[model samples]
Every structure is written in C-alpha cells, then in structure tokens.
Target: MDIGNRLKTVRQQAQLSQRELAKRSGVTNGFISQVEKNQVSPSIGSLKKLLDGLPMSLAEFFADAAESSSPVVYRLDDQPELGSADISYRLIGSHFPGRAISLLRETMAPGADTGPDLLSHAGQECGVVIQGRLRLTVGEQEFELGPGDGYYFDSTQAHRFVSIGEQELVLISANSPPTF
Candidate 1:
C-alpha cells in the first residue's frame, strides 16, 4: 500500500501545508515532503505524531474516513494493515461502525520498535506476547516479557513497544476507544 499517498490525501483534506503540518507535528518540513514523496518512510511513532497533529487517530487515518457497514464477523483477510516497513499492525474491523475498540495483531522485526517518541493516547491498552520477546515501556518503567506474557494499562500514560532478541516479536493487543 502507498502510505505516502494516503497521508498526502489526508493532509490535503485537512487543509494543511507541509510547513504547517511540520510545525504542528514537531517534524521538519523536509521530512514531511520526503514522506509524501515516498523518499522516506516514517516510523509508526513518527506517523502517529503527524496524525495527532491532524487531530486524527491512526485507525481513522487508515480507515479512509468513510462510512461503511460493520461486519459481524471478520474473516482473516478482512483486517486492514496500519503499519510501517518495520512493523505489522493488522487492525481488525477498522471500518466497523461505532467501533469502541482497536484490535491488532502486531509483528515487529528484530530490533524494530515503535520509534523514539513515546505513544500516549486515550482509554486503555492490553496485550499478550504470543511469540518472541517484547520490551514494553510505560512511563519510566520497562519490562521484558516473553511468550504467554500479558499486560494491561491506562493508555494515557506514555508507552512504547520494542522487539527484543534476534527474532520477530508477535503480539495481539487491544486499545479501548479505538486508539489503534
């Protein structure tokens, strides 16, 4: 998928110039231009910052901002990916009307992480490490968890996830209020 095109369309729809978006998102205008041109790929956290500047949720940004029917049951292929080159976030029911939760099956490459910026959002987040190792940082506390481990916490607190060890990290996570 061309995430750069998606981002460009969204930014234009929001009536934001690259300079304005950069100012709002704390990124350089050059960076924004590079991303829009696909000359550079923003990390998940970087993209999140840009979306936050647009006052949009990652789910909303990726959902194409359309009103669509919500399926009662989602097939495996029904999930939409809201991820970057280094990570995979397969979001289920992304277009579900009245969605109150964000469910994602995530996979991170070895040494891949959510980027330098900490992620903060509304509601709560919980997840379980299904494969490999996970390094979860919430507030100033950090924990190294392995398969079968799970966590729950308020989403307002700053947090980020890192893939530890030499293998890919896979997890299933959910955020209330659909923060994505």
Candidate 2:
C-alpha cells in the first residue's frame, strides 16, 4: 500500500489539516507534509505516534485501507481475522463508513492470552463473555468472568485478557475510535 496516500486519505476523511494533525501528533507540520508527499519514510514508532494522533491503531489503519468503500452487512465468513491462532479476533462492520466504534468477535483457545504487555489506548472498551471463562486484568485489579458476564472500562488503563477454562472462550467486544 502507498502509506503516504493512505495517510492523506485518512487524514482528509477525518477532516484534519496537516498542521492540526502535526499538533495533535506532536510532530512538525513540515514532517507531516513530507510524509504525505512521500518525501520521507517514517520509522514504525513515528508512524505509530502519528496514527495515535488520529485516535487510530496500526491495525485499524491497515484494515480501513483494505476494506471495501462501503459495506453495510458482513457475514461471519466475510469478517477479517486478526491477532494470532491462539486468540483470534474477527472484526465486525469493518467496512462501515465513518465508523465511531469497532465491534469484534473474539475466540480464545484455552490458555490463550492477549500477551504479557497490557493494552493502553485512547478510547473505551466494553465486552461480554459469550461462552467459557475469561480472566481480565485492568490496571491492578483482576476479574474472572463467565458467560453472561460483561465489562466496561477506560482504554487508557492497562488491560489484558486470558482464557482460563478448558473450553474455548467466545466474546463480543466493542471499542470507541475503533482501535482494531
């Protein structure tokens, strides 16, 4: 993909000028201009910082780029798979235009975990356990949730999830600003 063009498209879709984006991203207007013009390549960290300013994740950016222009209905098989084999995340309504939230169907194999590093981002996340058991850790607190149990929290807090039961864990989750 043309990262420069993609960035420009997203930036325009968000209705942000390069100066505004630069200010939000803590980068220089010149840098943003150079990036949009394909005059320079940003390091991964730099690109991530830029994306963060858009309140977007790297995954979301890529997904948005690959998504169809407009899609209202998505079948199970049509959803894009993300993450790894142990913990699969299928995005729902991924092609919806101007989406304010991201919906996901997650399946976690027994002993599967999001990882040791907790996720912290710029939005809010909510999820409900559809089946099996989940161990959720937010900040310093931990909770073991079963089917029908739900959770809501600020995404800024470090959080992680793990499957605790022998059976596979299924969950439906949503996040504002569509992190992934």
Candidate 3:
C-alpha cells in the first residue's frame, strides 16, 4: 500500500490542509510534507501523531491495507460519521454483526462542547486525547488534558468533552453499543 497516498486522501477528505493537520498532529509542516511525499518513513509513534489529525488509528490504517476480505476489517476511510451539533465522531466497525463493543474516533471543534449529562449504561469507556486540549466533565469533577493524555471511566458517570483551546480536539475512544 502507498501509505503516503492514503494519508493524503484521508487528510483531504477530512477537510484538512497539510499545515492544519501538522498543527493538530503536533508535527512540523515540513515533516507532514515529507511524509506525504514518501520522503520519510514515520515511526509508529510518529505515524500515530499524524493519524490524530484524521482521527484514525494505526490498526484501522493497516486494516485497510490488507487484501483479504475474511474477518472483515472496517477501514478507517470507510467509517461512518456520527455526531451531535458540537461534537462529531466517526464510528468504527459499524457494520459488524453482534458487535459487543464499539470504537470511535472523535473530533471537536474549538469552543465546542458536548453538553454534560450523566450516562447510565453498561460497559466502560477509555479515551486518549490526540490533539489540542479537552476539558472533560464527569459528575462533579472536571479535568483538563492535552495531547497524549488518557482517561478511562465507568459509563454510568455523566461525562462530556469540551474543546478548551483554539485548536480542534481529537480522541480515540472505545465503548459498548459502541459509542456512536
């Protein structure tokens, strides 16, 4: 697979410019340019950073590159978008039958907030902030996190995410019913 081409396609489809993605991904624009041109191969860590801008994962990216149809991989590029007014999430593995869990790649625009509400449900949720900063409100507590910060909590707690900085926020999350 041409990783550079795939990267470029996903970035454009996400409506991101190379500079914008670099800013969100915490990499230099020069580095993004080089990656897109296939002039440099990104380490897994570095590639994960780049994938943040597209709100994707290394598993999802590589899954799409595989040629087999058995076991059915849900390509990141083909994931369906799900969102309310302020926050948007891409649902991963939406088409799978009897999906006991779900994964999502989320993006929140600056100044956007997902309203605070207690969610009473089964299962657990864990997320890693991939870009910008996020203010998470759970029950009576609130916390702020920058890129690479991670959180895991019970789904029964009321929680919401707010973008706290000028840049957009990105997160990779997994939950049951799967969090679409």
Predicted model with the maximum lDDT: 2
Best by TM-score: 2
Question: Candidate 3 — which residues are off by over 4 angstroms?
Answer: 1-72, 116-118
Q: What local lDDT score does residue 91 receive in model 2, on the 0 to 100 scale?
A: 96
Model 2: per-residue Cα lDDT over 1-180, one tens digit each? 788888888898889999999999999989998998999998989999999899899999888887735667789887999877798899988767667899999999999999999989999999999999999999999999999999999999999999997999999999998997
Lowest summed-lDDT stretch of 10 residues in model 2?
A: 64-73
Regarding lDDT, does 1 or 2 come out ahead?
2
lDDT scores in order = 0.89, 0.91, 0.82
TM-score of 3: 0.56
Clashes of each: 0, 0, 1
Question: Best to worst by TM-score, what's the order?
Answer: 2, 1, 3
Q: What stretches of model 1 exceed 4 Å from their correct place?
A: 1-69
Q: Give one digit per residue, the lDDT tens place, for model 3 in 37-81.
A: 999988989999999877999997777546322246667777887
How big is the positional error of residue 125 in model 2, measured in Å on the Cα after superposition? 0.1
C-alpha positional error of residue 102 in candidate 3 after TM-score superposition, expressed in Å: 1.4
Ranking according to lDDT, highest score first: 2, 1, 3
